[model samples]
Target: MDLSELLDDLIRFWPVDVDDVSLIGHSMGGLVLRSAGHHGYEAAHEWTGKAKTYVSLGTPHSGAPLENLAHQASAILAARPETNAFGRLLRRRSGGIRDLRAGSLVDSDWQGRDPDGLAAAMAAEVPLLPGVDHYWVSATLTRDPKHPLSRVIGDGLVLHHSAGGRNSTRHIGFTEDNGLHLGRANHFNLLNDARIAAKLVDWVG
Candidate 1:
Protein backbone atom coordinates (compact mmCIF):
# COMPACT_ATOMS: atom_id res chain seq x y z
CA MET A 1 0.00 0.00 0.00
CA ASP A 2 0.96 3.65 -0.42
CA LEU A 3 1.88 6.08 2.31
CA SER A 4 -1.67 7.45 2.55
CA GLU A 5 -3.13 3.98 2.98
CA LEU A 6 -0.54 3.10 5.57
CA LEU A 7 -1.28 6.31 7.44
CA ASP A 8 -4.96 5.47 7.41
CA ASP A 9 -4.22 2.14 9.03
CA LEU A 10 -2.04 3.77 11.67
CA ILE A 11 -4.79 6.24 12.53
CA ARG A 12 -7.32 3.48 12.81
CA PHE A 13 -5.22 1.24 15.04
CA TRP A 14 -3.48 3.85 17.15
CA PRO A 15 -4.64 3.28 20.74
CA VAL A 16 -2.47 5.51 22.85
CA ASP A 17 -2.20 9.14 23.80
CA VAL A 18 -1.80 11.28 20.71
CA ASP A 19 0.35 13.59 22.82
CA ASP A 20 3.18 11.09 23.03
CA VAL A 21 4.32 8.61 20.44
CA SER A 22 7.64 7.13 19.32
CA LEU A 23 8.28 5.71 15.88
CA ILE A 24 11.06 3.26 15.04
CA GLY A 25 11.61 1.66 11.67
CA HIS A 26 14.34 -0.47 10.07
CA SER A 27 15.41 -0.42 6.41
CA MET A 28 12.50 0.38 4.15
CA GLY A 29 10.31 0.52 7.22
CA GLY A 30 12.08 3.74 8.09
CA LEU A 31 11.02 5.29 4.81
CA VAL A 32 7.46 4.26 5.59
CA LEU A 33 7.60 6.00 8.95
CA ARG A 34 8.90 9.17 7.28
CA SER A 35 6.19 9.04 4.66
CA ALA A 36 3.48 8.44 7.23
CA GLY A 37 4.77 11.27 9.37
CA HIS A 38 4.80 13.59 6.37
CA HIS A 39 1.25 12.67 5.48
CA GLY A 40 0.07 13.13 9.06
CA TYR A 41 1.86 16.42 9.43
CA GLU A 42 0.40 17.85 6.22
CA ALA A 43 -3.11 16.79 7.20
CA ALA A 44 -2.77 18.04 10.77
CA HIS A 45 -3.27 14.61 12.24
CA GLU A 46 -3.32 14.56 16.02
CA TRP A 47 -0.54 11.97 16.13
CA THR A 48 1.85 14.20 14.22
CA GLY A 49 1.65 16.88 16.86
CA LYS A 50 2.69 14.48 19.58
CA ALA A 51 5.29 12.40 17.80
CA LYS A 52 8.32 12.65 20.06
CA THR A 53 10.93 10.58 18.29
CA TYR A 54 11.65 8.95 14.97
CA VAL A 55 14.53 6.47 14.66
CA SER A 56 15.47 5.04 11.31
CA LEU A 57 17.84 2.07 11.16
CA GLY A 58 19.81 1.41 7.98
CA THR A 59 17.41 3.47 5.91
CA PRO A 60 18.71 4.64 2.55
CA HIS A 61 17.62 8.27 2.92
CA SER A 62 19.64 9.06 -0.16
CA GLY A 63 19.09 6.70 -3.05
CA ALA A 64 20.62 3.23 -2.83
CA PRO A 65 23.45 2.79 -5.32
CA LEU A 66 22.76 -0.90 -5.73
CA GLU A 67 19.19 -0.27 -6.73
CA ASN A 68 20.22 2.49 -9.04
CA LEU A 69 22.71 0.20 -10.71
CA ALA A 70 20.17 -2.57 -10.96
CA HIS A 71 17.65 -0.18 -12.48
CA GLN A 72 20.14 0.83 -15.11
CA ALA A 73 21.21 -2.71 -15.76
CA SER A 74 17.61 -3.80 -16.20
CA ALA A 75 17.02 -1.15 -18.82
CA ILE A 76 20.22 -1.96 -20.67
CA LEU A 77 19.36 -5.62 -20.70
CA ALA A 78 15.85 -4.91 -21.92
CA ALA A 79 17.24 -3.08 -24.90
CA ARG A 80 18.52 -6.30 -26.40
CA PRO A 81 16.36 -9.31 -27.32
CA GLU A 82 19.13 -11.74 -26.35
CA THR A 83 18.87 -10.68 -22.69
CA ASN A 84 15.31 -9.42 -22.63
CA ALA A 85 14.15 -12.32 -20.47
CA PHE A 86 16.75 -11.64 -17.81
CA GLY A 87 16.01 -7.94 -18.02
CA ARG A 88 12.33 -8.61 -17.52
CA LEU A 89 13.13 -10.58 -14.40
CA LEU A 90 15.08 -7.73 -12.95
CA ARG A 91 12.44 -5.24 -13.92
CA ARG A 92 9.90 -7.29 -11.99
CA ARG A 93 11.14 -5.76 -8.77
CA SER A 94 8.36 -4.43 -6.57
CA GLY A 95 7.25 -0.83 -6.32
CA GLY A 96 8.88 -0.78 -2.93
CA ILE A 97 12.22 -1.67 -4.51
CA ARG A 98 11.76 1.00 -7.13
CA ASP A 99 11.12 3.52 -4.39
CA LEU A 100 14.46 2.61 -2.87
CA ARG A 101 16.21 3.95 -5.98
CA ALA A 102 15.72 7.41 -4.51
CA GLY A 103 14.14 6.64 -1.15
CA SER A 104 10.82 7.97 -2.37
CA LEU A 105 8.16 8.27 0.33
CA VAL A 106 5.16 10.09 -1.09
CA ASP A 107 2.85 9.61 -4.07
CA SER A 108 4.24 12.70 -5.71
CA ASP A 109 7.62 11.05 -5.67
CA TRP A 110 6.45 8.46 -8.13
CA GLN A 111 3.05 9.63 -9.27
CA GLY A 112 2.49 10.12 -13.01
CA ARG A 113 6.05 8.95 -13.62
CA ASP A 114 7.17 5.97 -15.62
CA PRO A 115 8.03 3.19 -13.19
CA ASP A 116 10.56 1.67 -15.60
CA GLY A 117 12.05 4.98 -16.49
CA LEU A 118 15.77 5.44 -15.83
CA ALA A 119 15.25 8.73 -14.08
CA ALA A 120 15.02 8.12 -10.33
CA ALA A 121 15.35 11.60 -8.94
CA MET A 122 13.43 12.67 -5.86
CA ALA A 123 10.37 14.72 -6.73
CA ALA A 124 10.69 16.89 -3.64
CA GLU A 125 12.18 16.93 -0.21
CA VAL A 126 9.98 15.48 2.52
CA PRO A 127 10.74 17.51 5.58
CA LEU A 128 11.15 15.87 8.95
CA LEU A 129 8.29 16.17 11.40
CA PRO A 130 8.63 19.50 13.12
CA GLY A 131 9.51 19.34 16.84
CA VAL A 132 10.34 15.65 16.68
CA ASP A 133 13.69 14.09 17.49
CA HIS A 134 14.84 12.34 14.34
CA TYR A 135 17.66 9.87 14.77
CA TRP A 136 19.32 7.54 12.27
CA VAL A 137 21.67 4.54 12.57
CA SER A 138 24.18 3.48 9.96
CA ALA A 139 26.54 0.53 9.63
CA THR A 140 29.72 -0.21 7.70
CA LEU A 141 31.44 -3.48 6.87
CA THR A 142 34.89 -2.29 7.87
CA ARG A 143 36.41 -1.89 11.28
CA ASP A 144 37.06 1.78 10.77
CA PRO A 145 34.35 4.18 9.75
CA LYS A 146 36.78 6.20 7.69
CA HIS A 147 38.12 3.27 5.74
CA PRO A 148 37.59 3.64 2.00
CA LEU A 149 35.95 0.22 1.78
CA SER A 150 33.51 1.19 4.51
CA ARG A 151 32.60 4.35 2.67
CA VAL A 152 31.72 2.52 -0.54
CA ILE A 153 30.38 -0.79 0.76
CA GLY A 154 28.48 0.32 3.81
CA ASP A 155 26.47 -2.40 5.50
CA GLY A 156 26.94 -4.43 2.28
CA LEU A 157 23.73 -2.98 0.83
CA VAL A 158 23.46 0.72 1.72
CA LEU A 159 26.12 3.39 1.56
CA HIS A 160 27.05 4.81 4.97
CA HIS A 161 26.25 8.33 3.78
CA SER A 162 22.90 7.28 2.40
CA ALA A 163 21.95 5.62 5.65
CA GLY A 164 22.85 8.81 7.46
CA GLY A 165 20.22 10.69 5.39
CA ARG A 166 22.36 13.18 3.56
CA ASN A 167 22.95 13.58 -0.13
CA SER A 168 24.71 16.21 -2.23
CA THR A 169 21.69 18.53 -2.27
CA ARG A 170 19.50 17.32 0.61
CA HIS A 171 19.96 16.84 4.30
CA ILE A 172 17.45 15.26 6.67
CA GLY A 173 18.56 17.64 9.44
CA PHE A 174 19.71 14.97 11.88
CA THR A 175 22.00 16.37 14.52
CA GLU A 176 25.41 14.77 14.96
CA ASP A 177 24.46 13.61 18.44
CA ASN A 178 21.30 11.99 17.08
CA GLY A 179 23.08 9.55 14.80
CA LEU A 180 25.08 6.36 15.26
CA HIS A 181 27.60 4.60 13.09
CA LEU A 182 28.68 1.02 13.68
CA GLY A 183 31.76 -0.23 11.94
CA ARG A 184 32.48 -3.83 10.95
CA ALA A 185 28.77 -4.49 10.77
CA ASN A 186 26.24 -5.16 8.02
CA HIS A 187 22.73 -3.81 7.57
CA PHE A 188 20.87 -6.56 9.39
CA ASN A 189 23.21 -6.21 12.35
CA LEU A 190 21.33 -3.04 13.26
CA LEU A 191 18.42 -5.23 14.33
CA ASN A 192 20.24 -6.76 17.29
CA ASP A 193 23.30 -4.68 18.07
CA ALA A 194 23.92 -4.09 21.77
CA ARG A 195 24.99 -0.48 21.29
CA ILE A 196 21.84 0.25 19.32
CA ALA A 197 19.69 -1.37 21.99
CA ALA A 198 21.35 0.73 24.67
CA LYS A 199 21.00 3.82 22.55
CA LEU A 200 17.31 3.13 22.13
CA VAL A 201 16.93 2.75 25.87
CA ASP A 202 18.65 6.06 26.38
CA TRP A 203 16.54 7.74 23.71
CA VAL A 204 13.12 6.39 24.69
CA GLY A 205 13.28 3.59 27.20
Candidate 2:
Protein backbone atom coordinates (compact mmCIF):
# COMPACT_ATOMS: atom_id res chain seq x y z
CA MET A 1 0.00 0.00 0.00
CA ASP A 2 1.04 3.60 -0.53
CA LEU A 3 2.13 5.85 2.31
CA SER A 4 -1.10 7.79 1.93
CA GLU A 5 -3.11 4.65 2.48
CA LEU A 6 -1.04 3.77 5.53
CA LEU A 7 -1.69 7.18 6.96
CA ASP A 8 -5.41 6.59 6.43
CA ASP A 9 -5.26 3.25 8.22
CA LEU A 10 -3.31 4.72 11.10
CA ILE A 11 -5.72 7.58 11.51
CA ARG A 12 -8.61 5.14 11.51
CA PHE A 13 -7.20 2.78 14.14
CA TRP A 14 -4.96 5.24 15.98
CA PRO A 15 -6.31 4.72 19.48
CA VAL A 16 -5.51 1.05 19.32
CA ASP A 17 -1.82 1.63 19.87
CA VAL A 18 -0.60 5.22 20.20
CA ASP A 19 -1.93 8.27 21.92
CA ASP A 20 -1.35 10.92 19.20
CA VAL A 21 0.77 10.79 16.06
CA SER A 22 2.63 13.55 14.38
CA LEU A 23 3.49 12.87 10.76
CA ILE A 24 6.61 14.31 9.20
CA GLY A 25 7.03 14.10 5.44
CA HIS A 26 9.45 15.86 3.14
CA SER A 27 8.84 16.83 -0.52
CA MET A 28 6.34 14.43 -2.11
CA GLY A 29 6.10 12.73 1.23
CA GLY A 30 4.38 15.84 2.46
CA LEU A 31 1.82 15.54 -0.33
CA VAL A 32 1.13 11.93 0.54
CA LEU A 33 0.65 12.92 4.16
CA ARG A 34 -1.57 15.77 3.05
CA SER A 35 -3.55 13.49 0.78
CA ALA A 36 -3.99 11.30 3.81
CA GLY A 37 -5.51 14.22 5.64
CA HIS A 38 -7.64 15.33 2.70
CA HIS A 39 -9.16 11.89 2.45
CA GLY A 40 -9.24 10.92 6.14
CA TYR A 41 -9.80 14.13 8.09
CA GLU A 42 -13.29 13.21 9.22
CA ALA A 43 -12.40 9.85 10.69
CA ALA A 44 -9.20 11.17 12.36
CA HIS A 45 -10.62 13.62 14.86
CA GLU A 46 -12.84 11.25 16.86
CA TRP A 47 -9.95 9.07 17.95
CA THR A 48 -7.94 9.92 21.05
CA GLY A 49 -5.09 10.45 18.58
CA LYS A 50 -4.20 13.80 17.11
CA ALA A 51 -1.98 14.99 14.29
CA LYS A 52 0.46 17.31 15.98
CA THR A 53 2.52 18.97 13.26
CA TYR A 54 3.11 18.76 9.52
CA VAL A 55 6.42 19.88 8.17
CA SER A 56 7.04 20.25 4.44
CA LEU A 57 10.36 21.07 2.80
CA GLY A 58 9.97 22.41 -0.68
CA THR A 59 7.10 19.96 -0.98
CA PRO A 60 5.22 20.07 -4.21
CA HIS A 61 1.92 19.83 -2.33
CA SER A 62 0.42 20.92 -5.61
CA GLY A 63 2.27 18.26 -7.62
CA ALA A 64 5.52 18.90 -9.49
CA PRO A 65 5.12 20.55 -12.87
CA LEU A 66 8.67 19.58 -13.71
CA GLU A 67 7.65 15.93 -13.56
CA ASN A 68 5.10 16.60 -16.25
CA LEU A 69 7.59 18.50 -18.41
CA ALA A 70 10.36 15.89 -18.09
CA HIS A 71 8.25 12.87 -18.95
CA GLN A 72 9.06 10.26 -16.30
CA ALA A 73 10.02 7.59 -18.81
CA SER A 74 12.65 9.81 -20.39
CA ALA A 75 14.10 10.78 -17.04
CA ILE A 76 14.11 7.17 -15.88
CA LEU A 77 15.64 5.72 -19.07
CA ALA A 78 18.34 8.32 -18.80
CA ALA A 79 19.02 7.32 -15.19
CA ARG A 80 20.88 4.18 -14.12
CA PRO A 81 18.97 0.91 -13.94
CA GLU A 82 19.06 0.54 -10.14
CA THR A 83 17.33 3.58 -8.56
CA ASN A 84 14.87 4.35 -11.34
CA ALA A 85 11.74 3.33 -9.43
CA PHE A 86 10.22 6.75 -9.98
CA GLY A 87 10.59 6.39 -13.73
CA ARG A 88 9.05 2.92 -13.72
CA LEU A 89 6.20 4.12 -11.54
CA LEU A 90 5.61 7.05 -13.86
CA ARG A 91 5.35 4.72 -16.85
CA ARG A 92 2.74 2.65 -15.04
CA ARG A 93 0.62 5.69 -14.30
CA SER A 94 1.07 7.29 -17.69
CA GLY A 95 0.11 4.09 -19.46
CA GLY A 96 -3.46 3.87 -18.20
CA ILE A 97 -3.77 3.93 -14.39
CA ARG A 98 -4.35 7.66 -14.50
CA ASP A 99 -7.54 9.10 -15.91
CA LEU A 100 -6.07 11.89 -18.03
CA ARG A 101 -2.29 12.16 -18.17
CA ALA A 102 -2.09 15.16 -20.47
CA GLY A 103 -4.74 17.24 -18.73
CA SER A 104 -3.18 16.65 -15.31
CA LEU A 105 0.00 18.65 -15.85
CA VAL A 106 0.45 21.52 -13.46
CA ASP A 107 -0.50 25.03 -14.56
CA SER A 108 -1.66 28.29 -13.00
CA ASP A 109 -5.26 27.23 -13.51
CA TRP A 110 -4.70 24.39 -11.08
CA GLN A 111 -4.91 26.98 -8.31
CA GLY A 112 -8.62 27.42 -9.04
CA ARG A 113 -9.68 23.85 -8.34
CA ASP A 114 -12.32 23.17 -5.68
CA PRO A 115 -12.72 19.75 -4.06
CA ASP A 116 -11.35 17.64 -6.88
CA GLY A 117 -7.98 19.02 -7.96
CA LEU A 118 -4.76 18.52 -6.01
CA ALA A 119 -3.81 22.07 -5.11
CA ALA A 120 -7.31 23.05 -4.09
CA ALA A 121 -7.85 19.90 -2.04
CA MET A 122 -4.57 20.36 -0.20
CA ALA A 123 -5.01 24.05 0.52
CA ALA A 124 -8.62 23.62 1.51
CA GLU A 125 -8.52 20.31 3.35
CA VAL A 126 -5.18 19.39 4.99
CA PRO A 127 -5.37 22.07 7.66
CA LEU A 128 -8.79 21.01 8.83
CA LEU A 129 -7.46 18.43 11.26
CA PRO A 130 -7.74 19.48 14.86
CA GLY A 131 -4.53 20.40 16.71
CA VAL A 132 -2.47 20.10 13.57
CA ASP A 133 0.40 22.55 13.23
CA HIS A 134 1.78 23.02 9.73
CA TYR A 135 5.16 24.26 8.63
CA TRP A 136 6.24 25.31 5.14
CA VAL A 137 9.99 25.45 4.69
CA SER A 138 11.45 26.62 1.37
CA ALA A 139 14.96 27.05 -0.04
CA THR A 140 16.38 29.84 -2.17
CA LEU A 141 19.58 31.53 -3.29
CA THR A 142 20.45 35.21 -3.54
CA ARG A 143 17.66 37.47 -4.63
CA ASP A 144 18.31 38.57 -8.23
CA PRO A 145 16.75 41.90 -7.18
CA LYS A 146 15.57 42.51 -10.77
CA HIS A 147 12.29 40.72 -11.25
CA PRO A 148 10.06 40.82 -8.16
CA LEU A 149 9.53 37.10 -7.54
CA SER A 150 12.87 36.21 -9.07
CA ARG A 151 14.49 37.83 -6.05
CA VAL A 152 13.55 34.76 -4.04
CA ILE A 153 16.21 32.62 -5.75
CA GLY A 154 14.33 29.38 -5.21
CA ASP A 155 15.91 25.94 -5.54
CA GLY A 156 14.17 25.92 -8.99
CA LEU A 157 12.09 22.87 -8.11
CA VAL A 158 9.36 24.04 -5.78
CA LEU A 159 7.54 27.09 -7.08
CA HIS A 160 5.67 29.44 -4.72
CA HIS A 161 2.29 27.72 -4.81
CA SER A 162 3.70 24.34 -3.85
CA ALA A 163 5.23 25.80 -0.66
CA GLY A 164 2.30 27.80 0.61
CA GLY A 165 -0.08 26.52 3.30
CA ARG A 166 -2.53 28.62 5.25
CA ASN A 167 -1.81 27.13 8.68
CA SER A 168 1.97 27.01 8.46
CA THR A 169 3.91 27.97 11.59
CA ARG A 170 7.21 28.74 9.91
CA HIS A 171 7.67 30.32 6.52
CA ILE A 172 11.43 29.85 6.75
CA GLY A 173 13.16 32.08 4.23
CA PHE A 174 16.62 30.52 3.92
CA THR A 175 19.48 32.41 2.31
CA GLU A 176 22.26 34.86 3.22
CA ASP A 177 19.93 36.52 5.66
CA ASN A 178 19.72 33.81 8.37
CA GLY A 179 22.15 31.24 6.95
CA LEU A 180 23.76 30.26 3.67
CA HIS A 181 22.02 28.14 1.07
CA LEU A 182 23.77 24.86 0.29
CA GLY A 183 25.37 24.80 -3.15
CA ARG A 184 23.94 21.32 -3.64
CA ALA A 185 20.47 19.90 -2.81
CA ASN A 186 17.57 20.30 -5.20
CA HIS A 187 13.89 19.82 -4.45
CA PHE A 188 14.37 16.11 -3.87
CA ASN A 189 17.15 16.52 -1.31
CA LEU A 190 15.06 16.17 1.79
CA LEU A 191 17.92 14.54 3.64
CA ASN A 192 20.62 16.98 2.43
CA ASP A 193 21.46 20.49 3.52
CA ALA A 194 22.99 20.81 6.96
CA ARG A 195 20.98 23.92 7.53
CA ILE A 196 17.73 22.13 6.80
CA ALA A 197 18.71 19.24 9.01
CA ALA A 198 19.38 21.69 11.82
CA LYS A 199 15.97 23.23 11.24
CA LEU A 200 14.25 19.83 11.43
CA VAL A 201 16.01 18.94 14.64
CA ASP A 202 14.74 22.14 16.16
CA TRP A 203 11.21 21.79 14.79
CA VAL A 204 10.47 18.18 15.67
CA GLY A 205 12.11 18.19 19.07
Candidate 3:
Protein backbone atom coordinates (compact mmCIF):
# COMPACT_ATOMS: atom_id res chain seq x y z
CA MET A 1 0.00 0.00 0.00
CA ASP A 2 1.98 2.99 1.25
CA LEU A 3 5.23 1.39 0.23
CA SER A 4 3.81 0.71 -3.22
CA GLU A 5 2.71 4.31 -3.51
CA LEU A 6 6.18 5.48 -2.58
CA LEU A 7 7.75 3.18 -5.12
CA ASP A 8 5.40 4.42 -7.81
CA ASP A 9 6.15 8.06 -7.03
CA LEU A 10 9.87 7.37 -7.02
CA ILE A 11 9.68 5.71 -10.40
CA ARG A 12 7.53 8.43 -11.85
CA PHE A 13 9.56 11.48 -10.81
CA TRP A 14 13.19 10.36 -10.63
CA PRO A 15 15.64 10.72 -13.48
CA VAL A 16 15.96 7.61 -15.62
CA ASP A 17 19.62 7.59 -16.59
CA VAL A 18 21.40 7.76 -13.26
CA ASP A 19 24.06 5.07 -13.06
CA ASP A 20 24.44 4.89 -9.31
CA VAL A 21 21.93 5.66 -6.60
CA SER A 22 22.96 6.32 -3.00
CA LEU A 23 20.33 6.58 -0.31
CA ILE A 24 20.61 7.85 3.26
CA GLY A 25 17.96 8.15 5.94
CA HIS A 26 17.81 8.87 9.66
CA SER A 27 15.57 7.36 12.34
CA MET A 28 12.22 6.14 10.91
CA GLY A 29 13.21 7.47 7.53
CA GLY A 30 15.73 4.64 7.30
CA LEU A 31 12.99 2.05 7.55
CA VAL A 32 11.06 3.89 4.84
CA LEU A 33 14.08 3.77 2.59
CA ARG A 34 14.45 0.05 3.18
CA SER A 35 10.79 -0.48 2.47
CA ALA A 36 11.02 1.45 -0.77
CA GLY A 37 14.05 -0.52 -1.90
CA HIS A 38 12.45 -3.79 -0.92
CA HIS A 39 9.24 -2.86 -2.64
CA GLY A 40 11.10 -1.94 -5.79
CA TYR A 41 13.13 -5.12 -5.78
CA GLU A 42 10.11 -7.34 -5.26
CA ALA A 43 8.22 -5.77 -8.16
CA ALA A 44 11.22 -5.60 -10.47
CA HIS A 45 11.10 -1.83 -10.64
CA GLU A 46 13.83 -0.42 -12.83
CA TRP A 47 15.26 1.88 -10.14
CA THR A 48 16.16 -1.04 -7.90
CA GLY A 49 18.90 -1.96 -10.31
CA LYS A 50 20.61 1.41 -9.95
CA ALA A 51 20.65 1.37 -6.16
CA LYS A 52 24.22 0.99 -4.99
CA THR A 53 24.50 2.17 -1.38
CA TYR A 54 22.06 2.63 1.47
CA VAL A 55 22.81 4.11 4.90
CA SER A 56 20.65 4.22 8.00
CA LEU A 57 21.36 6.46 10.96
CA GLY A 58 19.92 5.61 14.36
CA THR A 59 17.22 3.38 12.92
CA PRO A 60 15.57 0.90 15.23
CA HIS A 61 15.63 -1.99 12.85
CA SER A 62 15.07 -4.61 15.54
CA GLY A 63 12.33 -2.46 17.06
CA ALA A 64 12.24 0.35 19.59
CA PRO A 65 12.22 -0.92 23.16
CA LEU A 66 10.57 2.30 24.32
CA GLU A 67 7.59 1.69 22.04
CA ASN A 68 7.33 -1.86 23.31
CA LEU A 69 7.29 -0.53 26.87
CA ALA A 70 4.65 2.02 25.98
CA HIS A 71 2.54 -0.68 24.35
CA GLN A 72 2.75 -2.78 27.50
CA ALA A 73 1.95 0.22 29.65
CA SER A 74 -1.06 1.01 27.52
CA ALA A 75 -2.42 -2.47 28.05
CA ILE A 76 -1.99 -2.20 31.80
CA LEU A 77 -3.76 1.16 31.85
CA ALA A 78 -6.57 -0.15 29.67
CA ALA A 79 -7.26 -2.90 32.21
CA ARG A 80 -8.51 -0.33 34.71
CA PRO A 81 -11.39 2.08 34.15
CA GLU A 82 -9.51 4.78 36.02
CA THR A 83 -6.87 4.85 33.30
CA ASN A 84 -8.77 3.68 30.26
CA ALA A 85 -8.80 7.15 28.78
CA PHE A 86 -5.04 7.45 29.09
CA GLY A 87 -4.61 4.02 27.54
CA ARG A 88 -6.78 4.92 24.60
CA LEU A 89 -4.87 8.14 24.13
CA LEU A 90 -1.59 6.30 24.09
CA ARG A 91 -2.92 3.82 21.58
CA ARG A 92 -3.88 6.74 19.40
CA ARG A 93 -0.29 7.26 18.41
CA SER A 94 0.13 7.47 14.65
CA GLY A 95 0.75 4.42 12.48
CA GLY A 96 4.29 5.60 11.86
CA ILE A 97 4.99 5.53 15.58
CA ARG A 98 3.42 2.06 15.86
CA ASP A 99 5.54 0.79 13.00
CA LEU A 100 8.63 1.66 15.06
CA ARG A 101 7.66 -1.07 17.52
CA ALA A 102 9.03 -3.62 15.09
CA GLY A 103 10.76 -1.68 12.28
CA SER A 104 8.11 -3.07 9.98
CA LEU A 105 8.78 -2.14 6.33
CA VAL A 106 6.11 -3.95 4.40
CA ASP A 107 2.39 -4.80 4.38
CA SER A 108 2.61 -8.38 5.59
CA ASP A 109 4.35 -7.18 8.70
CA TRP A 110 1.19 -5.61 10.11
CA GLN A 111 -1.72 -6.32 7.77
CA GLY A 112 -3.71 -8.78 9.90
CA ARG A 113 -2.38 -8.04 13.37
CA ASP A 114 -4.44 -6.45 16.12
CA PRO A 115 -3.18 -2.88 16.37
CA ASP A 116 -3.24 -2.92 20.16
CA GLY A 117 -1.54 -6.27 20.57
CA LEU A 118 2.17 -6.37 21.37
CA ALA A 119 3.08 -9.79 20.07
CA ALA A 120 6.59 -10.56 18.88
CA ALA A 121 5.16 -12.35 15.85
CA MET A 122 4.07 -9.00 14.47
CA ALA A 123 7.73 -8.28 13.68
CA ALA A 124 8.17 -10.07 10.39
CA GLU A 125 11.58 -9.92 8.78
CA VAL A 126 11.85 -8.14 5.47
CA PRO A 127 14.66 -9.23 3.22
CA LEU A 128 17.38 -6.74 2.26
CA LEU A 129 17.98 -5.64 -1.29
CA PRO A 130 20.05 -8.39 -2.92
CA GLY A 131 22.86 -6.34 -4.39
CA VAL A 132 22.71 -3.08 -2.48
CA ASP A 133 25.32 -2.22 0.10
CA HIS A 134 23.54 -1.40 3.36
CA TYR A 135 25.26 0.52 6.13
CA TRP A 136 24.16 1.66 9.59
CA VAL A 137 25.18 4.17 12.25
CA SER A 138 24.22 3.76 15.89
CA ALA A 139 25.03 5.70 19.05
CA THR A 140 24.89 5.54 22.84
CA LEU A 141 24.81 8.17 25.57
CA THR A 142 27.63 6.74 27.59
CA ARG A 143 31.26 7.25 26.71
CA ASP A 144 31.69 3.52 26.41
CA PRO A 145 29.39 1.56 24.16
CA LYS A 146 29.77 -1.49 26.38
CA HIS A 147 28.29 0.31 29.37
CA PRO A 148 25.28 -1.53 30.75
CA LEU A 149 23.04 1.49 30.32
CA SER A 150 24.07 1.86 26.69
CA ARG A 151 22.92 -1.64 25.93
CA VAL A 152 19.51 -1.05 27.50
CA ILE A 153 18.69 2.63 26.84
CA GLY A 154 20.92 3.58 23.98
CA ASP A 155 20.84 7.23 22.88
CA GLY A 156 17.93 7.63 25.29
CA LEU A 157 15.48 6.07 22.80
CA VAL A 158 16.64 3.22 20.59
CA LEU A 159 18.83 0.43 21.91
CA HIS A 160 22.29 0.16 20.39
CA HIS A 161 21.55 -3.34 19.19
CA SER A 162 18.25 -2.33 17.67
CA ALA A 163 19.80 0.62 15.86
CA GLY A 164 22.32 -1.74 14.37
CA GLY A 165 19.56 -4.10 13.26
CA ARG A 166 20.42 -6.99 15.55
CA ASN A 167 18.06 -8.90 17.80
CA SER A 168 17.77 -12.37 19.32
CA THR A 169 15.54 -13.54 16.45
CA ARG A 170 17.68 -12.36 13.54
CA HIS A 171 20.52 -10.21 12.23
CA ILE A 172 19.35 -7.98 9.40
CA GLY A 173 22.39 -8.93 7.32
CA PHE A 174 24.60 -5.98 8.34
CA THR A 175 28.26 -6.85 8.70
CA GLU A 176 30.48 -5.37 11.39
CA ASP A 177 32.50 -3.71 8.68
CA ASN A 178 29.51 -1.88 7.33
CA GLY A 179 28.37 -0.41 10.64
CA LEU A 180 29.53 2.57 12.69
CA HIS A 181 29.02 2.86 16.42
CA LEU A 182 29.38 6.10 18.31
CA GLY A 183 29.59 6.52 22.07
CA ARG A 184 28.99 9.56 24.32
CA ALA A 185 26.38 10.65 21.82
CA ASN A 186 22.61 10.70 21.46
CA HIS A 187 20.47 9.44 18.58
CA PHE A 188 20.35 12.73 16.72
CA ASN A 189 24.10 12.93 16.76
CA LEU A 190 24.13 10.42 13.97
CA LEU A 191 22.64 13.07 11.71
CA ASN A 192 25.43 15.63 11.56
CA ASP A 193 28.35 14.77 13.81
CA ALA A 194 31.76 15.24 12.29
CA ARG A 195 32.58 11.58 12.70
CA ILE A 196 29.49 10.56 10.82
CA ALA A 197 30.17 13.08 8.08
CA ALA A 198 33.67 11.68 7.74
CA LYS A 199 32.36 8.17 7.52
CA LEU A 200 29.90 9.17 4.83
CA VAL A 201 32.72 10.71 2.88
CA ASP A 202 34.65 7.49 3.12
CA TRP A 203 31.69 5.36 2.18
CA VAL A 204 30.09 7.39 -0.61
CA GLY A 205 32.01 10.54 -1.20
Candidate 3 local lDDT, 53-153, one digit each (tens): 89999999988988888889898898899999999989998888888988888767778788898666466678888888889999999987779989889
Q: What does candidate 1 score on TM?
A: 0.90
TM-score of 3: 0.92
Could you arrange the candidates by TM-score from highest to lowest?
3, 1, 2
Residue-wise C-alpha lDDT for candidate 1, range 12-113, written one tens digit per residue: 588853447789999999988988888878777766776788999999988788888899999999999999999999999998888898888877777778
Global Cα lDDT for candidate 3 = 0.84
Model 2, which residues run further than 4 Å from truth? 1-17, 45-48, 68-128, 141-153, 166-185
User: In model 1, where do residues sit more than 4 Å from their true spots?
Assistant: 1-19
lDDT of all predictions: 0.84, 0.47, 0.84
Clashing pairs in 1: none
Cα displacement (Å) at residue 51, model 1: 0.8
Clashing pairs in 3: none
Q: Worst lDDT window (10 residues) for model 2? A: 96-105
